[model samples]
Structure formats: structure tokens, C-alpha cells
Target chain A: MNAIVSAPAARLVHVPLGERAYDILIGSGLIERAGHEIAARLKGRKAAIVTDENVAPLYLDALVASLEAAGIVSASLVLPAGEKTKSFEHLMTVCDAVLEARIERNDAVIALGGGVIGDLSGFAAGIVRRGLRFVQVPTSLLSQVDSSVGGKTGINTRHGKNLVGVFHQPDLVLADTDVLNTLSDREFRAGYAEVAKYGLIDKPDFFAWLEANWRQVFAGGVERAEAIATSCQAKSDVVVADERENGPRALLNLGHTFGHALEAATAYDSRRLVHGEGVAIGMVLAHEFSARLNLASPDDAKRVEAHLKTVGLPTRMDDIPGDLPPAEVLMDAIGQDKKVKGGKLTFILTHGIAQSFVADDVPSSEVLSFLKEKHPR
Target chain B: MNAIVSAPAARLVHVPLGERAYDILIGSGLIERAGHEIAARLKGRKAAIVTDENVAPLYLDALVASLEAAGIVSASLVLPAGEKTKSFEHLMTVCDAVLEARIERNDAVIALGGGVIGDLSGFAAGIVRRGLRFVQVPTSLLSQVDSSVGGKTGINTRHGKNLVGVFHQPDLVLADTDVLNTLSDREFRAGYAEVAKYGLIDKPDFFAWLEANWRQVFAGGVERAEAIATSCQAKSDVVVADERENGPRALLNLGHTFGHALEAATAYDSRRLVHGEGVAIGMVLAHEFSARLNLASPDDAKRVEAHLKTVGLPTRMDDIPGDLPPAEVLMDAIGQDKKVKGGKLTFILTHGIAQSFVADDVPSSEVLSFLKEKHPR
Candidate 1:
């Protein structure tokens, strides 16, 4: 992996949602400038920073110094790290601490970790005082490319992941690629799945570009920043067009249905499958399923699987550790997906690479049989 | 209270929020039509009905029958009735039950009771699937005129009331005046405070109309339907103008700031002071505070107090059942109000009745002194 140390100029991708539109700033060293960027845009000088234990030691001081340098006073709550932190108990704790800190409406809530922190903090911000000005300083590649851009903030309930949340747009998103350097190799590989997702969604030229530049992206070069910018722009366009996901926005969930069911089948054990890893495998499954349905060429499925495998991401059910549940169990979990409309399965299927569309009224029997063939348990 | 029980034609009040807009159906026996009304708007055939213990016996069967008649399959979750049920525990129960029922995004979560059920159920709906189709069959006058119309759904926290929730609008609201006949006189009087709140906010003509026709409104006459419809219209307009409470919508909290402080002081003991009754006293305090600030005439406060007294609503701190805390404590509670902006007190101080506005940067010292004068502890 190449290490290019000098910080590049930041690129701004604006998500226009009328009054709720905000900008996502992408580059290395953006976190050190977050205080200035946020203070310039928001009127209030006080803020509450919500982060996790893993992120606080490495990044919290720089964040605090930046805020202090900008004359912005802040209080913070450090939660336990990982997906389990996205719970009602932690949400309540954050809400109480925010209110206890006297963080008022005009003041901001800065989510300074990965997806869990962003979702939980954004949710607390969304509900406290009806809503608060929110700033996202996402520390992981997955959050920078996906969760941080969209206003979909929430926590996981036992029923499902991200089943509870609100569409709360951030006032600003600072996606500092420098933070990604601290992430483990496995974790970085996981986030690359979502970065690859945008290319597969509708950008064929971008997909071709990613296939060539995947190594530079992994190596934290200018290509890394370029990929993040491209992903945010794609997401911003979708979010602005359908902020509420009433129509076209559903296309963004290209691999989420199968991804979520796979996670559920594992009982959301991160040891077996992290979200983006699940998406890696799910995307491969979706492409393969499309091929099986004769909607796409088998070559496209092979291409998707090959790229995901090259990135060191899991791209098949067999890639997950341990004996898997029978296909019927996985099928049942898919039925519980939020995308299912009136008991009909809705899948984001591809005609070929970068040619995805929402396929509603998908035959359940076909899915069950496909899963049965794939699992063969 | 008179018991004139033949059903009247429904009155429809449209809350125009562009595409997010919905209609509030007010009159007698609208609950009996809830199934068809909701079925018409949403394509999904399954529903999860959320109600409280008190409402289940009184109206749940009728609601189920109505849905059955419309060929809508249903499941139900009955919660303990009252303000206490609006907690995290019940919210989790409701979320779990809805997911267990497999209520899809296109399907609905019907809130079939009063403000407590509406707030909790609507919150469950808001978070479940990120959001679900919602229908409000409000069984109490307070809910019909206030909570059901605004889409301000949430649960109470130890820090304060409505400290957590989402602005999830219902696809349909059925406000059946016939249900009001079953309420105890005190309960009905409490709801009357919210009805009076609409008039007090910015409708002097409606206030004058209410002052004259309040007796008929209490009697379940045609005036009752008229009163509910007018109040719904008043709230609908405000909600449309500011869906997120960022501006003029704060006027709706005319009595709520002081009222919430009082409720907190009493440990939210409904026996001592229910929400609407607390709002009654709080509204009087607001008017009096406006007079003290020379923002309005003292006679405006007096007139407001007298009208509330005539309707058997509590209008002063002394009307509360228990011995009270010192002014400093009450002042501290007010400091914690969600309306407090940047450690400054914000009040819905009025020019007089029907002339309310959001007053930001109100001095905390001034509030303390006024509370000291009013409480005289």
C-alpha cells in the first residue's frame, strides 16, 4: 500500500434537499479543519461530540483542539465501540447526556466515529428538542461513503438492524480520509464493498475506473479521495431526488436486502460478517441471482465476484465462518426486510453491471428455490 | 354534560404539507369508518393496532370489526394506560410486536387510543421500517384536537416529556366526537384546555366563539364537532407552516413550557395534574408573565384565568394538589425545557389572548423573579 502523506485540497459534494441540503467535505486532514468548517456554518459556539471508545483516544484530542482553536466549547460522551452500541439503552444514555450537557437546539451534535456513532448520535440529535443542528465527522470508509451522507439515522432493535430511525440531514459531513489510516486491514476492506456499490448501481464508467484503480484506492492515494467523492456525489443525487425513499432512492439499497438477511442469519455476529462484508457477498448474490433469472449475463456475476474477492471481501455465503442456516431460514429473514411491500419481495436486480433497477413483486418461490440451490444444506 | 348520541356527518380538515399532507376527519362515529378510510389511502392489507388498557375494552373490538369489514388483517398490542406507558419499555414492546406481525412499509400501524397511545404508537411507527403508514383513531378529546393532528409523536423520558420522538404524520386521522361522551368530566375538561389552546394561540375570533359556545361544545352538540374541526384547522395551518418547529410553530407551545416544568415538579403525577390541566395553569402563567413584562395587559391574564375557571380547569400554581417546591427549583426545571435556546429561556409570551409569539433570549433572571413572585414560597 502506497503512503502519500501530504494532505490534498478538500472536495465538497453538496446534497441539495431544498432547506435541508448540506455539503460533504472529502480529503485527508479535514478533521483538523472540522471546527472551522462547522463554526463558520453554524451560529452556536457550543456542541456535544458523540463518539465511541475506540475513536476517542486516537482522534478526540485533535477534534477538541480544533474546536478550542475555533473558540467552540464542546462536551462529549464516549460509548462502547462496535455495532452493539447501537441500542435503546445507549441511545437513552446519549440523549440524557446531551440534555444534561445543556446542548440546545442551535448547538450541534457531532458524531465522530463510524456508522454506529453516526446513527445513534444523529438519532439523539434528531429527537432532542425535536431536532438539533448535526455535523458528521465520519471516521470510517463505510460511513464516509454511505451513512454519513444520507440523513437516515437510527439504532438497531432486536427485530432488525436500522428498523428504527429518522431521515435527519446533517448540517455538514467531514469525511477525512486520514482517519481511515487508523482502521484495521479487515475493516478497511469491509468498507470498500460500499465504495464499490456506487459503481455497480448506475455508473458504468466509474465501475471500469474502480476496476483499474482499486489498488490506489486501497493504498490511500488521490484515487482514494476520488472514489469517496464519486460515491458521495452518487448518494447525494439519489438522496436529493428522493429524501424519503418513496421511489428512486430505493435503488441505493442495491445489495441491502440480501445483506441484511445474511446478517440476521448470523444473529448479527460481527465475527462472522460485518455489514459491508455482508453487502459484498449480497451484491455477488444479487448479480448471480439476476443471471439465474436470465436478467443479466453470467459474466457480470463473475466480474462482481472477482472484484470483491480481489479486494479481500467475502463474496459468497460459504465465505462466512461456521455452518450456515438452511436456505428456508435465510428466506424467512429476507421476507422481514423493510423493502418487502405487501408481502411481495422487492430486489435491486441488475440487467448487467451498472444497470440496476428495483424489481418488485419478485416471486418468493423463485428466491426460495435459488437459495435452496445455493445453500444445498 | 348532555348525551346526544346520534352520529353526525364527518368534517374533513386538510393539513396541506404538499405531498406529506393528510386530512383530519372529525365528527361522530369516524372510528367506525377508520378501516375504509385507511384502506383507501394505503395498498397494504395488514395492520398492527396499538392501544392502551383503558381503550381496548371500550373501542378495540369495534375497530377490529371495522377493519375486518374492510378486509384488512390485524393484530393488536394493549399497553398499560396513562402517561407512564409512554416510556422506552413500551416503545420496545410495540416495535417488537409490529415487526413480529410482519407489518410492512406499505402496511399501517394504527394508534387506536388517546395521546399516550398516539404518541407511543406513532413513535413505534416512525422508527419501525424507518417509517410506516400510520393512522390515528383518537379516542380522547385531547388527542383528537392536539396530538393526533400535529404528527408530534414520542415517548416521555425522565429528563422531560416528549424528549424523544419523530415528526411522523399519519396518513389519516379519525377524530370521533362520540367517544368524548365516555370520558369523565375531569378528563373532558382537561382536553378542553388544548381546544382552548388553539384559540389562545392566534385565533381571537375562535376564542370569542368558544367563550360563547363552550357549553354546547361540552354537551356533545353540533358545536362540539364544529369546535374540534376549527381547532384541527388551526393546528393544521401552523404545522404546515413549520413542520419541524423551527419558527412560528413554537407558538403552539403557548402554555407548554411552564406546564412541563410544573409536571416535572410534581413528578408527572397525573392525579395531581394531567397534561392539559398543567397547560391550563401554564397558559395563565404565560399571560401573566407577558403582563409582567409589559408585553400585554394584566386584564388579558385575568380574562384567560376566568375562562379556564368557568370550564373547571385549573388556572394557578396553587390549584396543583401537593405542596410545591421553591421558585428556584421550578426555575431550574424551566432552564431544562426543550425551548431553552443557548442557556436562555424562550417563552410563548403573548401580546394578549390570540396574539402569541416565540420570545427567544428571555432573561432567566426575569423568569426566576416572576416565579418567585407567583409562587411566594
Candidate 2:
């Protein structure tokens, strides 16, 4: 992890999925070089850039100019920016726009925003023409560190989030740290939750390093790039080991099960809690639940809550504004989670910090009791 | 092929997709034994059957009884029958119903009808939980031989048919020939077109055999089972070789490009033409187109048209009930075909019967001119 941070040049984390293998380039100023990198990798000269309203004004011109410099003709689709945009309605819009753009199978669909844009665009790319060449230009830190690296892409349904989609890997992923400099402080902190999640998953040394040098990471430079690279490397390793999330990959969802339930409980209202914020609280809850189950030390849960609180992330259910539903309602949402295999809850519980493992058939009564303690009545 | 037809209690064609490999069981009485076969292969004791209105009344109860006999809990969603049913609306309905049934990842999603039901239900199964155990109990001849074996599951979009879907293979396929006895005469003849397609796609001897024994196949004894198994074998070979339709799999699209265009021309009206009828005409056009390009003898084209005509399948654009759009309009639709690469038309042209190859850069003017001859203004 330190070697990756100390590297002077741009870092390339290769996700090895045999024939579907591709590289995730992490460093400063990647958006400017995206054209050359993408052109070098793919033979197509046409591209469709799918961005959100918030992102297009900031980076669309630069990306289009970069592609133009590389002799790649391009079209753009600017969607509304928010979690709400990750729905079937927006999915159809993206699919239609792509087809209308005449983007062929060999051409590329460049997703140029956060997780919402990436998920929606990747899904459109996967289905349109039965599949198209896809490139991820994840502008947000949360997406760059996590969502961009994995092949999981989908839109949310009324039933649940990401319940309908496919595993369509991108041909290339450009994670430009330079772009994160433009992010608001709150947005960066939300994304940092995911960055910290990697360390909590299996890297004790890295978690300790973050505890010491998180200030430098927030200040933004080599440390920020290193954190992103480390996160990508960590995710890539797990994905390569289990592309379909059949086993070890579930470890990556340590915070996600509880996080998704929280999101669903709020009806995915981003103003109340964005994905990473929900994850921040969710991770604490996971640790607490682990401690409750005697799977881990209570001190580990306290440590997680303290660190997330220091970073200005929500670490408790109370952090969310307005009154949420009862604990039983939250449990109902969790029951509907995609992780519940064969009517039994499956969770990533920790033995200690950086020692996460999948625990299947987790008793729902225990989860309800835990939530009940967190939210009285 | 003869060896497979003769000494078989039930012919098994193994589709070798490595880890995703499974067997296609073909014969009479397989439906009665479906529950046992599925229970033996998969650990789950629950299934959600997605059939259509026409099929549910005919076989749903028997299927339910079979599952009960094996101690497998089963539920079903009966959709309206037809090509039009393969839509996002119906897809969402199936997804919701399956979720409402609480069908877990280990459970199976059984498609128990023709092409529409198979495509839609398979798609629902694929996306329900990022995929579920899919079983194809295809009832119609079209589905048994063609759609059921391949994992290409999806819904038709406003842009084109099958424009939105995933390549999700089934865990097991049960194609009972006895079910074909109940199909309408037109539907049976329509399905025979796909069965004959296998023979036309690289198996000259199979084509010869099909031409000789088509009447016997229609009579529904051993010959029907042989033809279905042979078609599945032919398709399985191509699918296993190129699971994603990247190379040799394109050969399977011999008539689909023209056929899809014709379907679009007729607005996908069953009163005018069904999919197989369109393919029958499209196959003749493809042969005639190849002959026009001096790639094959005109005699081959004539023989194909003659054979299709003898089978009571439409072999010409004139045979379609309604008037078609002008040649340029047809060419426009063909240009929008998903198979088009980089805006250039890609066709599967034949050298002779059963000797087809992917032909790229086919000129629009040539296709338009050919269509003009068929439908002069």
C-alpha cells in the first residue's frame, strides 16, 4: 500500500478478468489523457458521453475536447443529477439516447460522473446493441474508489436498489484525482467513508495508516491518490477472486447491507443521506452488531464510530434528519435486501478491525433487537 | 444425427460453457419428470414459473403437480401470450411477482411457454437477484429448438426487438416434444422454420435429412424429438464456442437481420407474420442475396425457397398479408439492426445450404435494390 502511494507517475491497477481484463488508471490529470488512453486500448473512433447535469458543466467540455484531440467523434447526454436518476425511467432515457446517437457495439459509452451516472450508463451500455464497449470516467471519489472498479451495474427498482441489472465490466476506468479537488467538503467526506471501508475490510496496517495520515489525505495530493489507488487495488483483488460475488466478494459489502436498508428506509432521499453517508452509519452499525453477536470486540465498534464522527460522517441513526420508521420497519427493508439468500440474512461481520467475514443465516430477531436499541420505540 | 435419433430414451445435449455448462433434455415424458431432474441438479425446493395465458391453462397444473410430487414449492405468473408481451412493463411485473413470491437465489425461475415467455421470464430471472436458477420448460416448437437453449433473455424495446436483454444461460432446460402436439398448426409450422434453420446454418446433411423427414417430424413421434435435439445441439455448439456472440455465434443470425427488418416493416403483427415466418422469408432473401453477390449459385436460393414453400412457410416478402414499406425504408430498418458494426451493415450470407459466413460491409444500395425487386413501388 505504501509503495503504491510513493509512486511518482500515474498508477495503473489492473483488474484481471481473463479476456475481460482492463486497467484502472489512478492519478492527477487523467481526464485530459482519457482520449489517448481509451484510443490506445480500443479500436473504435466514436463515443457517447453519459454525464449528469451537475458534472457536465464542470468536465464535459474538457472530456469532449480530449476525445476530439484523439480523433474520436463524440455525443453527450446530460441527465438530472441525483439518486433519483438511477431508476427505470432514466435507464430508458439513457438507452434511447445511446441508440439515437448511433453508438455501435464497437464504439464506447463513457460514464462521466458519480455512481448514479456510472450505474445507469453502464446498464445502458450493457443492454444497447446487447452490449457495447464501456469506459468509466468516475468523477466522484466514492465512484473512483469503489463502484468504478467492480462490474456490478444497475438501476434501483421499487422493490429495491440495484435489483435489476447486469455485470458489465468497463473496458477502461480513468480515476482522476485532480477532479476530486473540485468536490465539496461534504461530498469528499461521504466518499472518504468508502475509502476507509477498504481498510476495515482486510487491511489492518492500512487502517492504522489512515488513522495517522487521514489529514494529509483530506488535504489532497499524493496521499489522496494513494488512498484511491489502494482502494481500487483492494476492490480489484476481491473482484478477480470472485467476479460474481458468490463468496469472498461479499466481504466488500460489509457496510452495504445495513447501508442499503438505511437508504431504502429513507426512500433513497439523498438530501437526508447520500449512499456513502448511509454506509458510514451502516459500517458503525455492522461493527456494533458484530460486537453484539460476540463476533468482535465492542471497542472496535467504538473506534469505527469515533473515526467516522471525526471525519464529519454520520455514524448513528440519529444523524439522519427527521424520524425514521421503527426498527421492525428497518428490519423489513433489510429482509428485502438482495443479500438475503434463501430467506436467511447474510452479513459481513467482523472478528476485529480488518477481519471481516460473511456470516450467513444471521438471525433477524437479533438485528431487530440491535436496531431497537439504536432507535427507541 | 441418426445415431442420436435412434437409440435414445431421452437425448441429452450438453452446452459446454465451462462453469455455466448444463444439459438440454429432449424427449416425450420429460415434463412429467422435470421436478425430479431439477431437484437432483439444484438444492432448492422452490420455483416460480413464468408462463403465458395460452400455456398456463394447458400445462401449469401438471407442472405444479410434478413439483409437488418432488416436494418443491411452486408459484406462477401467467402473462398474456404473444410477441408484444416481451416488454419492460411485463418484465417489471414478472420481477415483482417473483420477489413477492419470495423466491430466493437458490430457487428456480421456470419459463413454461414459447419464445416470448422464455425471453421475458429468463430476463426476469436474470435480473431478479442479479440472476436466479433458470429452467426452460419450453412448450412451443420455436422455443424448444431455438429460444430455450440459448441464454439470450430480454424484452423488445421501442427501437427494435431484443434490443434490451442479457446473455444469461439457464441452469437446466427441459424440452418435452409431447407438448408440441398441442400447438396450433400455424405455430407448429412456424417453429419448424427455426428447426430447419439449424440445418441451413452449417449442417448440409442435417438440412438434407430435414428436407426428407420434415413430414415425419410434423407427425410428432421420434422424428420430432430428433429434430428438436439436433437444433439444440447445433445452437449449443455455436453458443458454447462463442457465449457472447462475439464470433461464430453470428452465424446463428443468418435470417434474423432480414427477418427482424421484415417484422419491423409489418409492425410485428402476428396477423401478417410471426417471427419464424419472417425468418423463412429472410432465409430465402439471404440465400438470394448471396447468389446475387456471386457467393453461391442461384439454384441454392431456389432450392431454399422451394423447401420453405413446401413446409407452408412464407418464402417471399409478397407472402406477407399487408403491404410493406419501400425498399429504402426496409434498408433503413436493416441499418438500425443491432448486428450493424460501426454503421456498416453486417450480414450472415450463405455459400450454399448450411455454409454461412459473417459478411461485413454489405452495401445498403445492394440490399435496397434487392428489396426493390421484391417489392416494387
Candidate 3:
């Protein structure tokens, strides 16, 4: 608890996964110090930074300069910005670039943007030369709080999102909170959905804190850093407990199953629904579904929705700015999720706030009916 | 000793890699027993078999029948048989196929071909759903003794062979020696190169045994089983000692540095030189280079060449049946090898028979000069 509330000048959350353990450094201006920090921890002096076109103009130069100052040589590959970048084609390009740069097993492949770049680059680093040292410099709040902390690096395939990937943990993560200042209001709000998720999964007090200090967190300062650190810590705990997602780690996907379905339903058009927004709507639906199942109170569902809505997040299917498919279509999307085992629905259902449990035998008929009742006319 | 000579019914060499440890079951008719063996060891009832076109007609039906007999539902993906099949295109295909088959994490992806299919499919299995249980039903000698044992799964990039891959260990390996009956004389002889490699690396007695009983081993029975079992055990020991090739595992790459350069020189053209043929020549070159460096007697080099030549394998650049690349070009290929650390050449030089060691700082000038001396005009 003390660690979570520590002064936010810079928060270092260490993910202790034995030999693969790494530190997540969250602070302002950390990117300016990226070179020295990376050189101090990693043996290789060469790095290949994979960023997006959007982020490249913003921070790639500064990052390269920092690495140069630390005497670490680097090359940069800037891909198109967006969720579409997480594809096999992009993965191959990044891998080839890393190889062309002669980034060896000990050399670093740094992901210097949001989740897409982080995931795509992290995957290239994982497979190129059978695994290189990976570093995540997450630019968005969503990534800094969630994706960057866990070593779940991968790309999306036609069959589904994140259906292909590796569990390649990073050697270091530099989450420069200052960069969050550059995010759009929607992007920042979308990221907040994940921050709220950490609390909803297991930390009721943290959820309560975010609810009380939502404004301060949005304004960005000690509160923002505190929120990010706690979220990372929560994710790290889940990841370390079940690094392979064999059991309790499923709790972290509380809204993801439904969220992924919604994203699929919207054809993953960011104009209609981005990942975190899908998650926002999905989290509300999860709570509502739990209530319908008599597993939690409907008041808890309303509370979840209200917090997300207050943070400027989309909290319902109708909240999406496009016409979604029928409930049956959404159910088909859920059925396609890798989470289904032996043709049975497996979901993270809650008893109440911060009390999620993995329900491995959730009936599909029940979910379809729930979606039907909630579907926008 | 008893373990090595156990009455030839079937030999199970347990690779003791802690939690990731698995068994290599080597014997005749094991493919017919693959389903039972896999079912007994794995919890999954579903499997996706990735095989090359050449092997599918020969073994796919029998494998499917065996799995059906054991109550395992199976899907088969037939790919073209060759080193070229180890590519990102095929990797994506296998991954997509596995996902389309809805193979869960607990399910299995079985490789039922040679090194190319095993490498590609194992990579897919490792990544799909972040990893599925993998089973290797290696139908080729090279695969049975080497590629299938180590869990070094990957695809080739335009940069190099095995330049991209993952360390995805299989849950079980069924090395059906009876499959060897279907192999061509050339293919069998090519595989014999790796069988002899185990002996050359650290087993003087095994080398002497192979030299004495080479005929019986080639004839295929107890001696052939002994050769494969010994090779697998030797490889398992090295992998257990260093799974990631950070240390002693480099010894397994004995002859491989020169072999890869030769393969590159020939443009990986199978008609010009196959992998094991390159290895056959490279082992001779490695020993000859060791002799030139005064690391071992020239008599040892002569002996290595004599055995391989007697076994109908190419033992020199001149034996490659085509014009050879200039020494400088070959050196360029060697320089590009991932084994090169900070621009210094790394090779497996030997002290004497069965006493190979990783030479981390081998002088490139010496290698060039040695290649020039050995180059055929």
C-alpha cells in the first residue's frame, strides 16, 4: 500500500518474474533519459526503435539522441499509426528491419509508441534471432498502465485479434508520463478505462480512489503517476501469478472477451470504436451480465457504468457512434474468441466491485439473451 | 550404459529441462503409436498436424487413423516439402490454419515431416493462442536426432536460415524409425551425418561404435536405433545444460557455421547441396581447420573425412558437384552468421576426437586463409 502511494516524482514498479524480471519506470522526462537507463540495465549497446509515424515526429529524435548520448547505437523504423499495424505483414517488416540493423540476441528492440507499436515491435524482438532484449517505452496511458507491463506481445491475424503472439517479457519499460499530455481527450479517456479495470478486477479501494480523484488523474500529476503505478503493479501481480494465463490471470480479461467481440462487430473501425472504448462498454456489460446472472447487484453495474461515463468513456453498445450488428452477430464474435474452451463460454464474472472470478462454464444461451436484452433497437 | 543399450523395443530419452522437460521416444512403428503416446502424456484431445506434401501421402493417413483410434480429433495441413517452406508466409498459413481449426492452448499442433515442417509448425504451435501443446512426430532422420529434439522452432527469413524462430519445446516426440525405410538412399545418408555428429562432439566411444557398425546402422535395426537414441540423448544433455545456446549449446553448432556458409554459398539449392551434405563437408572442414590451427592432429581431420566419405557423404568443397564460391565470398557469409559477436568469428574448434569446444574469438583472417587453401579452382 505504501509503495502504491509513494511520491510520484517517478514510480518504479518492478515485475519480479525470476530471471525475466524487469522494472517499469513511470515518470516525466524518462524518455530523455532512455539511453542511460537502457545501457545501465542491458548489455548490448545497439538498439532498434520501432515507433509509429505519429509518435516518430513527437519523440523518436529525442529517444535516438538519448541513446546516442549514452553511446548506444540505434536505428528507427516508423510504421503507420493505428490498430491495423498489428498484423503479420507489419510483424515481418519489423523482424526484417531488426535483422538488417543487426540487432542480435542481446541487442535491444525498443517499442516507442502506444500498444500497436509496442506489440508489433515486441513480437519482432521476441522472434528475431529467437528472442532479443525488449524494451517498452509506452506513450499512451492504456499501454503504460496495462499492455506495457505484461509481456503479452503479439500481432493480430485475420482469424482474430492477438490470436498470434509470444510471451516475450521485456528487459525494461520506460513509461514517460509526460507523453500522455500529447494524447487526445478521447485517447486519454479510453486509456482510463484500463486504469479503472485494474481496480474493478481486484482492488476496490483503488477503484474508489479513482472515482474520487478522477479529475486529478485526468489533469495529470502525482495522481496520474499514482494511478498508472498501481495499475501496473496490479497487472504485474496477475501476470507473475499466471504468466501463461493458466488460471487466475483470466480475471484480468474481465471485459476483454466482450470488448473483443464488440471490436469485431464494429469491424475494428477505430472511427466507430477503439479498443479501450470497446473495453469500457464491455466492462459495463460484464457487470450488467453478472447482475443478470444473480452473481452481483445491478447497483454495482450502474456504478461501473457511471464511473466510466464520468471519465468520458463509452459505457454501452448504443454509445458507439455506429450501428452494431444484432446480438446474435456479437455472440458469434464472442464465440470466435480463443477464450472459448470445448465449445463452452469462459468469462470473468464478478460477485461485485473488485471481486471478479473466472466462470469457465458460462452458458452461451444466457450471454446471447443478455446481449439481446441490452442491444440497441 | 544400460539405458543406451536397452533391448531395442523402444527407447525413451527423458530431456530433464525442469517443467518444460519431455521425452524422445525412438523406435520402429512409433508413428503408429503416436496417438496413444501423445494422449497419455498430453491432456488435449484435439491436434493439428502440419506435414510436407511428400510425407502426407506416406504417413498422414496412418497418423490420422492412430489419433482417431485414440479418440483424438485431428486436422492435417499439407505444405510443400523443402527448406524454402520455412518462411513467414508458411508460418502465417500454419497459424491461421490452427486458429481456423479452433485448436485451443491445451490442444496440440503436431509436426509430421522433416526439419522444415517441424520448425514452421512448432513455431505456429508456440505462438497460436500464445502457445499450444506441441508434438513432434519426426519422419526424417535429421529431424529425429536434431531439429525435433531441441525445441528450436523457427522459420527462415531472407536474411538467413533459422534467423527467426522461438524456443517452443514439444510435450512429446515420437521418432518412428520405421519411417526411415521410406527415405531415399541420399536422404538417409544425409541424416547419418548428424548421427555421427553426436559422436564427433563428445562421444568417442559412440564414434568408434558407428565406425565399426556403420553398415548395420545403415541397414537399419538395433544399431540405427542406438545411433538416434544416442544422438537425441547427447542433444538433450546439451539443451538441458544450455537451452538458449548462451553457452555450451554452441558446441551443437559444430560444423554448422561453415555448413551454413556453404549452404549460403550454394544459395541453399538442394540439388547443389542439402543441409546435411553441407554439414558433412563442414565437419571435415572444421576438423581440417582445427588441424591447420594445430588445435588437433591432421590425422583427425583425415579420419573424419574418411568416415563421411566411406558413408557416401561429401567431405570437401570439391565433392559438392559444382563450382565453389571464392574464399572471400564464403567469409562474407560467415561474417553474416548470427554467431559472429561484435564482428569476431565464432567456431566450434576441437582439441581431439570427441573434444569439441566453442571458439568465441576465432580470427577471421585465419578462416579466410584456410578456406583459400581448401578452395577448389
Q: Global lDDT for candidate 3?
A: 0.90
lDDT for each residue of candidate 3 in A1-377, tens digit (9 for 90 to 100): 01112233678899999999999999988988888789889888899999999999999999998898888999999999999999999999999999999987778999999999998898888899889999999999999988887788888877778989999999999999999999999999989999999999989999999999999999999999999999999999999999988899888898999999999888888999999998999899999999999999999999999999888899989888868899999898898888978788999999999999999999999999999999945
lDDT of each: 0.90, 0.89, 0.90
- The digit string of per-residue lDDT tens for model 2 on A209-316 reads 888889989999888888999999999999999999899999999899889989998989888988999999999999999999998999999998898898889999
**Model 1: CA > 4 A from native:** A1-8, B1-8
Selected candidate, larger TM-score, 2 vs 3:
3
Model 2, residue pairs in steric clash: none
Greater-DockQ candidate between 2 and 3? 3
Which regions of candidate 2 fall more than 4 Å away from where they truly are? A1-8, B1-8
Better of 1 and 3 by DockQ: 3
Candidates' chain B TM-scores in the order shown: 0.97, 0.97, 0.97
* lDDT, candidate 2, B1-377, per-residue tens: 01111223789999988889999999877877887788889888899999989999989998998887777899989899889999888987898888888788889999999999999999888877778999999999998989998799888877888888888899999988888888888999999989888989899999999889989999989888888888999999899888988888999898989999999988889999999999999999999999999999999999998988998999999899878999888888888888887677899999998889999889888988988987899
What DockQ does every candidate get?
0.73, 0.64, 0.74
* Runs of candidate 3 exceeding 4 Å displacement: A1-8, B1-8
lDDT of 1 by residue, B199-256 (tens): 9998999999989989999998789999999989988999998898888989989999
TM-score leader:
3
**Per-model fnat list:** 0.81, 0.64, 0.80
Clashes of each: 0, 0, 0
